[model samples]
Target: MHTAAAVADFHTYPLISALTHLERLPDQLRVQWADGRVSPFHYQWLRDNCPCPQCVYNVTREQVLEIVDVDEDLVALDAHIEQGLLCVRWHGGHTSRFDPGWLRAHAYDDESRAERLAAKPKSQLWDRAFEWPVFDYAALMEDPAALLQWLLALRDSGLTHVRGVPTEPGSLALIAKRISFIRESNFGVLFNVQSKADADSNAYTAFNLPLHSDLPTRELQPGLQFLHCLVNDADGGESIFVDGFAIANALRDEDPEAFRALCEIAVEFRNKDRHSDYRRLAPIIALDALGEVAEIRMANFLRGPFETSVAQMPLLYRAYRRFIAMTRDERFRLVKRLNPGELWCFDNRRTLHARNAFDPASGARHFQGCYIDRDELLSRILVLQR
Candidate 1:
C-alpha cells in the first residue's frame, strides 16, 4: 500500500526515466526490445504523448497507434534491473513494452534506430505543380476527357496553354465553350501586334493602365481572364502579370490592421468610355459581408479617390500605396512573352494582369482573350477533386 510520504515525494521528483520501472506494477507491464533487452516504465511517459487532447490532431484517430498491444508485453526476466528499465522505455515508446522476462527472451536482438520527420510547409492554393498532367504544349485539345482534364488542370494551375488552336476569327469562341465563364475585355485579345499596318500605334500605350483587379470595384470581378496569344514579335510589348491573391495575403499577414483599413474603407472607380459602361465603389481590399476576403482593387484608371472620413483616408491611402508596391515588386510579378496558340487563364479577382507598350513598327502580334466567372472554375475543381 502507498504511504502519504511516498505520494508527496512523488510530486517532488522530476519524473526521471531511470525511476520509471521502479514503480510497483501489476504483472501486466513487461516487454522486450529490438536489442534483445527488457524494460518497464511507469504510466507517466505512457500518458504524455498518447494522442490525447493534450497531444495533436484534437485527439482524433487514436487507433493509429494502440496502447492495448502493450498489455501482453509485460513479463519477468533474468536481465539486469537498470538495463531492463531502459529497454522497457524504448519498447514502450513503440507499440508495446516488457518488464523483465521478455528482455531476456529477446536478449539476442540488435539495436534499432528511429526518428520523426518535420512537417511540410503549406503551398499557395494556386501553385499546382504537384498535381497530375503537367502543362505541356504537345497535348491535343480534341479528346473530351483529355480536354476536360486539360481545362481542370488549367484551373488548378491558375494557368494553361492551348496548342495547335486555330489563330483565326472564331478561335476564341471554341476556347470559351471549353470553360464556363467569359471575361470580355477592351480588346478581343491581348495582342502585341507589331505589323507594318500598325506603324504609328505601338500596341496600345495609348494606355498605361493602373495595377488593379479587372473589375473588383464591382461585387464580382471576373474570376478568370483568358489570354490566347495568336502572335508574338515585338520591341516594346511584354505582358506584366502579378498574383494579386499572394500579394493580398502577404499584406494581410504583414500588418493586419493596415489590412483591416483596406478591408473597411470604400473607394470609387468610374470609367464610362463606351458601351453601357458604369463604375463601382467598394473597399480596395474587398471582402464578403461574412468577412471572407473576396478580391482587391488598386487602379489608377478606375478607382478615383478615397471616400472615407478625413481621419481614415490617410491610413487607407497608406495601405493602398503599400499594396501597389507589393504588387509591382519583382518577387510578386511574373513577366512572360505570350506567343501564338498559347492561352493562359487566371483568377482575375485574385490576379492583376497588364501589358507594356511595344513598337508596332517591327511587326504585329495578336491575341484573343476573354473572361469567365471565378466560382465556375472553383465549383468544377471541387467536383473533380472530390
Candidate 2:
C-alpha cells in the first residue's frame, strides 16, 4: 500500500509479480520476483531513480538527484522486501523504496529485457495488394476511440486514409491538432499544392514528381504528412505511394550489399531558394539500435551529387538506383486518386509518395498539406491509450 510508483511517472504499472527476495551486493541490489525471474539494479541507478520528494520533484515527477552527487563507492547498508516493496537503506544513511510493479517493469535482466523487446509493437509491412486502413473523419473528430484506432494504424501500417474531411482551406490543421501541433518548415504551416510560375520546389509545379519522402534535406524530416484534397477535376495527378520500409527489407533480402550501402553510406540532400536553404547528410536507409529498418531519407529531386570514395561511388549509385527501381515496382506501389472530401495521412519517413503529371490547362486541382512529427503522434497515442 505504501508505494512511490504513482509519484514517479504517469504510467500505472500494476504489480505483475511480487517482490519475493532482495540480496545486497557490493555495488548493486539483486531482486527476485515471485515468478522466479531475477533482476540486478545498480545502487547508483536506484538512488538516481529515487521517487521520494527529496530525490524527485513531486509536481513533474522528474528526477532531481544526480548520480555524481553520491559517492561512487556507495553501497547498500541493508536491503529487504517489506509490504510488497523493495526497500534499501544506503550506506550514507539515505533510504529508497521501490514499488514492486515499477521495479518489475524496469527490470533489466536478460530474460526481462528480452520479454520487453519482444513485446514492442512491430511494423506491419504492406504491399500494393494491402487494403488501406480507412477512417471516417467525423468519427475521429468526435470520438476518442476512433482517434486512437487511426493513430495505431498510422503507427503500425504507416499509411491511412480519412474520408468526409472538409474540403475548405486549412481544414487539415483541425485534424492534425487531434494529434499535436503542426511542424513548421520553410514551406509555411500549411502549404498549398498547385502549379506556380515561381515554384520553389517540384511539389509546387505540375511535373510528375518521383516517389520520395518530404523534406529529407532537414536534419529531422517531418514524421507524418497530411494532404487533404480540396479539388481534383484535373486529368492525371493520381497519387502513388510505396512503403519504403517494405522495399528496404526486400532489398535487404534480395540484394543485401545494396541495402548495406544505403544504410552505411551518407549522402547530401539539399533544398534552396532565393529565400532559404536547408541541407542534410544522412544514409538513405536508417537502422535502429537493433539493426532493424527505422527510416528512409530519400528525395531524388533534392539530392546533391554523390560524395564518397571513388571505389564506393559506383556501389552507391547501384544501390540508389535499385532503391528507386523498387519504389517503382508495381508489386509494392499503391496508386489512388483522392477526391474532394478525402485525405491521405501517412508516415512521411517510411512512406514515399509521388504524383503523376497533370495538365494545368485541363482543369483545376488543389490540395493543402501539413506535417506533424512522430513524437507528437506517439505522445497522443499514449495519452489516449491511458
Candidate 3:
C-alpha cells in the first residue's frame, strides 16, 4: 500500500528497493535499503518535504509549508520504519512520513546520484554525414509515439525534417502546436520569410545569409525553430545547416585556446530598425554547471563591433574568424533544398542555419517560421512519455 506522501507528488515513484532499517541522529536520519545502499536525510529536508494534507495542498499537490516557519534547529524526536515508510516525529508536535519508494528515488547517496547522472539523456552530436532524421507529418499528428520520436530527434540530434505537410499558408501553426505554444518575439508570433522591397533584417531579402542562430540579440534565445516551406518555386535558396555543438567540440579538440577565447569573451549582438532596437552582450559559447557546452550564440549580421581589451583583441579576432571559417567548411555543412509540403524543425541554438541567395525575379518563394522555448519541448516530452 502507498502512503499519503507517495500519492501526493505528480510522479509515481515505484518501489525499486524496500527500506530495511532507519537510524535517527541528532540532525538527520540514516536509512538502509534492501539493496545495501545508505542514504542520509536531514531533518530539515524531511520536514520541508512533508506531503501531509496539512503541509501540502491536496488539490494542487504543492507544498504549502515553508522551511523558514519551522525552527532551524528542528530535530526529530523519533524516527522509525513502519509499514515500509519512514515516520519521523519532530521535537514539537509535528510529524512527517516519507514513502519508501519516494525516499529511494530521491536518495542523495553518492552511488545513487552518480547512477541518476549517468542515465540522463545526452546530445548525440553529428556532422554533414548525419543520416537525416525525417518523420511523416501525419504520423506525428496522430501517434503519440511518433511525436515523441520526432521530439527526441530534435533534442538529441538538433535537426529534423517533417514531410507530407500541407502547403497552406498557416499550416505551420498546426504542426507547431503539436509540440506546445509558440514563443512570440518582436517579429510577431508567425513571421514570413520572403524578399521585400523594404526589409528590416537581412533574412527579409534575397541574400546569401551566413550560418547563424536566430535572435542572439535576445536575452534567452529560442530553443526550437520551425521553418515550413509553403512555396519553393524560386531558384537557389537551398538551406544549409551545421551542428554548432559538433563544430564547438572540434574546436575544443583542435585548438583549445580558440575554444577558451570564445567561451570567455563576451560580444554584443544588436538588432535595430525604425521601430525597435534590441541588444545583448554574452559569450559566444555558454557552459553548463558541469562545464559542458550547453549553448552557442552566433549571428554575424546581428553582431556589433567587437569590444575587448587591447591585449586580447588579436586572440578574440582569431577565435571569431576560426569559428566562422569552420561553419563554412565543407566537412560540417549539410545542404538541402526544402520543397513545398515540407518543414525543417531544429534546435535553433545548437544548429546554425543559412540560405544561399535566390533570384526573386525567377519565381516566388515563401516560408513561415515560428519559435518554441526549450522548457515547453521538455515538458511536452515528459507528458507524452508518461
TM-scores vs. true structure, each candidate: 0.58, 0.97, 0.96
lDDT of 2 at 111: 92
Please tell me which model should have the higher lDDT, number 1 or number 2: 2
The segments of candidate 2 whose C-alpha lies over 4 angstroms from its true place after superposition are 1-7
Q: What's the TM for model 1?
A: 0.58
In the range 336-366, model 2's lDDT, one tens digit per residue, is 9999999999999999999999998899999
For TM-score, candidate 1 versus 2, the one ahead is 2
Residue pairs with backbone atoms closer than 3 Å in model 3 (clashes): none
Ranking by TM-score: 2, 3, 1
| Top candidate (TM-score) | 2
* Worst ten in a row by lDDT for model 2: 1-10
In model 2, the clashing pairs are none
